[model samples]
Target: MEATGRLPAVRGIDAAAPFRWLGWAWRDLWTTPGPLLLYGLLISATSLALSWAIYRTNAAFWVLALTFGFVFVAPMLAMGPYEAGRRLDRGELPRVLDLLLVRKALRQDVAYLGLALLVIYFFWGRIAQIVYGLSTWQIYRTIPEFLTFALTTAEGQRMLLVGSGIGGIIAYGTFVLVAVSAPMLLDPRASVFAAVATSVRAVSRNPGPMLLWALVILALVMLSAATAFVALIVVFPWLGLASWRAYRELVAEAPEPAAARPLNPVATR
Candidate 1:
């Protein structure tokens, strides 16, 4: 915000901040239910379709990839919900069109962020395949068989341990980049670099609370996946809104544009 050279400074939140975000997100969701819930359903459907595609392949590795991959790709998918959160903040109800075809999300900086995450996603998938291949000569095709191997056998257990360790490092690094960047893109003032810079600062500044936040998101996503993503219709939106709150609270807002910005229906509020 200052001469485009210095980005906004992040404020450190207490460990309880993540928990409080849930309450705010829940309120925002119902306050603008029609659009946000519909948006969540859309994401849930996409998740189910993606999971089903991998299930059809009978490749347990991709299944595992897709499960953890949710954490990697979720922030990109949550852009619409971020807009919804912004709208709610301004006392405006988001419309279905706004949620579906988000104008702000279509810009170049977001595209860069999306591309970076996509690359990270594929890299994670490749690493997963490598781990699975190294774990055993025989590939486990069926989910049940894979489950037995993963849960009961020593080789399978070791594979999980090693893979999770690697994946956790990658996931946490991805989180540091995306913790606020994705939502910050909603503002015209934020370029991807500045957004990511601010995101990294916030998490590094408050690791304990941010780690708790990350774990909370993983737990919720796992629960939703357990239901074949039925719970995601609610949980996804809740998290998305919470993420917006995370951005708003973590970093101070940029100064308003000098000229009158384009009139947005939500901005009018």
Candidate 2:
């Protein structure tokens, strides 16, 4: 459908669109199960090894800090699979390396990606500090005073409760925007503002499905982390493809006009 002057209003589609999109996603996975499995295993093993090393050194805090940094860079790796899926949808063959190369070509978008990460990091750090302070009140307080506070007060509990609520809102907002923006950035033709706005609107319009998707993504993310990152390779690919399919389904596609043909004297005669 062509853009009708105004941007399309968000509306419900056939209930079956999601199912159809999912079926296609599964078919794509089935065709490339080997690499996907191997990838997941490798990610799991690496995450586990790195985590074990960090824990042994009593550098859990450092590990947590590094995760803040990783959040910015890790999405770049998924760009390849994301692009590959987009191409697959368009009936174009895309190589594994194409995912990596595409990012290089879209250097400007990478800057936007970084800015998005910074926004996430700032909120995450604030939430972390609040929770950490509540957990470690004794370190800063005099021993006797700390004991008195803990024994007589509900201050820590209140801090934790408030922190959790704030953190949840930040998490939900971040998830909704980032989930779709990464793939939208891959297009390079679309503006970052448009991509993010569309993503937010998409989630708002279909809260039920989007929430289900968010939960599923969270589960997979936790599973990957629990397995030490090996699960990420498979989970990442699956999720990446699923995400691309979701975008394709939820966002309105702009219609293109028919291409003009070259004029030929023989045809005219």
Candidate 3:
């Protein structure tokens, strides 16, 4: 989606948007880490439970993969900043328990997220096929005087490189879209498409900071893996709050009134 307009000009490139985002993120952590932690635990538990159930069933690879995709959508409603925003606006503290109670909104969000995931998966599948075809061609070319040897070597390397590239593209797209869409979805005023579009445009316009953000996310994911995924309890909430704050910063808004009461912060369902 196209950016609404060029990013607003500020005084110094050195004082960039991401640094400002970092500051907002820090403030959220300090003021509301308890709520964030609760949200994270809810997300992590449901996700792990779904994944373990699928794994234990010895499901087909594609079946397991699709189930995993569905699992991600389920938690989006719970972990999404948009849900928090809605709750905050209503003067309710965001809580994991809200997910159990907010059935209608949760269902609506799940449907929206599921549709997005399907579209993403369709494109991703095509990209995977392309890489597999390339790999097969490479293996065929690598077949030595002995057809078996050269073919196998060439195919393996081709598949490896092409698969990696496809994965990278998918990862980058997911990051850009997921970054802002959740919060947008939570806002009663915003449409899902608008949120996704805005997110994509935000990253496109601010490539440098977005890259740094992506790196930070990746590092967190790596650290989580090292901790047997336990680190996500902290990392997920931190990033979720960070994303909400980042969305507010990147998107334009009117200045707050000097004497107005602070906006109520809510958790997304």
Candidate 4:
């Protein structure tokens, strides 16, 4: 069950395709505005609650790390949107309860993928803590103190430089692994190995578009976090829907009507 029989062919795309994906996401968002917005709110609330807990405990360092590691859990968080997108793609009305429950993702491989992401998250946290510990013996529990030290001290600058470099590498690897895999798993035939392999191929074949997509996602998600997750109510759903669009185009080779296809459609199932 490690592989989903065989890998699906990846379609190449132009770098500007991510923008169109966002447009499609916007269009899809309105199809079931109430359920989708409510879904986004639910996730936003969960994220806010987690962030509040960290802030409450005065874990300033973790708050910063969590922001950087937010994408780690994103694929898992995106299940609902992916479900909605897939339903919409099939010319079927996306069921409210189905989108809400995301029952399709309650499979063994999904659990395995979630565990992998969880491990990556904790590993990144530990590495970030080590970097901070090496930079300064004293821990800054408060946000103001941490921000001041991180912005002013030479050691803090060095820590930021090194940590960012390491984090970027890890993030890119995670992106490749989860990009198509997450949504691909919704199919009963998908396995962790096949999904990951297909995702890697999708990135490898369309490096430019994939990187552009990754950056767009990063910028938007960070912007949402910058607002203390208030924007996440909309941003997360937008990105999730877009991610699902990306997955369908890159992983599944389903034929689409001319009106539905974006740019040059490449269906190679």
Candidate 5:
């Protein structure tokens, strides 16, 4: 679709809007489980593979880098769910291959926006490490030992507060950049700048509901991580579909083209 001359109006939704979107997302998932489940499984397997690959190196940085960096990649990960929701809206069944069909988006602005996010995520991980370094002098050799130190020490508590604060800032920034921009990128005609601006405006206009939505996402992601990413098999897809609905609601409809600039009055006369 081509970009309309004017940007659409972003709707102001209530706090309950996020829940409603989730309900719609859940319905989309069950309505077309086969493909979404397969996509989810693939993501789960990839995450496991990454964990396994990094664990062998015994490097905490690599592990943490990928773990936290997963957030940066999630918008891309959920592209399939976004498409599924679109299909459902059109009363069409979503296909499994649609998950891999992002090649079209990749050729356009999505890939560039994704790269920008990657840079931000890399810096976020670096900031997290700096926080850890400043807060602790202990050098633990193992995951369990490190966990114990963090849980049982004053330095660890301070580190948690500092790190979490910094992390939250980075996460919020990324959310504002990608929330609606990503879906807009799926449209071939939309430029990255325009998409990002639309997203910022949407969040600005609907701060309450958007913040609520972000909190909901954070809660679900934490739950999934706590379960060792297993819960993502469901939660991940659900969030994806819901995000698509969010974009649809937030971006305004395109304006009608100017009626062939009415023939010059004098010429018509």
Candidate 6:
């Protein structure tokens, strides 16, 4: 539904807002640990799968691609915590089933948005491969091999500079699209295009605080990746909930339903 009459006013937040969002997210995580933790476990499994792929192929490029690629597609995955935060805000405990229910609810919007991101991620991987190929003819079989070449060779340095520069642009674009749209999609009244518009507008109106938020996300995601993604068990859900906080602060808060219901209800007999 397009609110062409008066667009939702995006509030201008200060740099400190991102830190505040993190605090709120921390609270949301502990309040509904079961569902949020299940979400984290799923991320852990994905990390393991990626690690297995990298090890099997001995393709260090994949490692680099996935390391940054996660930030590109995290909003959709973080939908679980966003839903949890929404329920918790409504004075209800979010059930594990909401994980599935939230996905179902945003099926149309998320599918389109998620696909757009997946395309960008694939393009990024291809570009990374090209950069690596140009920089080094030899494929690295291990982390040490890759790091030595990357840190010592001029070609390797150039590749790092170019690849990261392009990746940063892509990541910023993805952030602008979904920083608020994912949560907006969760709202029963919001349409995909409308949510996207609001998200872009929100970033445009509050670039300083939004950039701070983006940096916070990058730092946290990098930290999670550093622990072989083990830290993702907590970082993933924490960021998800934190994103919900960001959306809440940026857009005018939607009115909660008068009567709350489980995200997923039992099937009728």
Going through the candidates in the order shown, the clash numbers are 0, 9, 18, 0, 1, 0
Alpha carbon lDDT of residue 23, candidate 1?
80
Give model 5's clash tally. 1
What does candidate 4 score in Cα RMSD to the true structure? 3.1
State which candidate has the highest TM-score.
Answer: 1
lDDT of 4: 0.83
Positional deviation of 115 in candidate 4, in angstroms? Answer: 0.9
Q: lDDT (CA) for every model shown?
A: 0.84, 0.58, 0.53, 0.83, 0.75, 0.80
Residue-level lDDT tens digits of model 3 in 17-44: 5555555555555455576676667666
Please, what is the TM-score per model? Answer: 0.92, 0.70, 0.63, 0.91, 0.88, 0.91
On residues 135-203, what C-alpha lDDT tens digit does candidate 6 reach at each position? 888989877788888889898899889988988988998899989998778875677787888899999
**Candidates in order: C-alpha RMSD to true structure:** 4.0, 8.9, 7.9, 3.1, 8.0, 5.2
Worst 10 residues of 5 by lDDT: 260-269
lDDT of 5 by residue, 1-269 (tens): 33565665677777887887888788778988999988887787788778777676675545654676677778877888877766666566778887768554766577788789879878987887788778776556556766776678888878777877878888888999898988777676778887888899999998888989988998987787677788888888889988987887667652222234321111111
**Residues 12-62 of candidate 4: C-alpha lDDT, one tens digit per residue:** 888878997898888888877777888889877887888889988989899
Find the 10 residues in a row with the least total lDDT in model 1: 260-269
Candidate order, lDDT descending: 1, 4, 6, 5, 2, 3
Query: What C-alpha lDDT, on a 0 to 100 scale, does residue 108 get in candidate 6?
Result: 74
The candidate with the higher TM-score, 4 or 6, is 4
Q: How close is candidate 2 to the true structure, as a TM-score?
A: 0.70
- Model 2 lDDT per residue over 1-269, tens place: 11233333343445454455456666666555655545445555766677667666755543553443344344545666666566666555555456546753366765686677777767677666667576654442233443354346687456546755765576677777766667767664566666677678878888877776766666667676655576676777777677667766666652211223211111111
Task: Give per-residue lDDT, candidate 2, residue 187.
Answer: 61
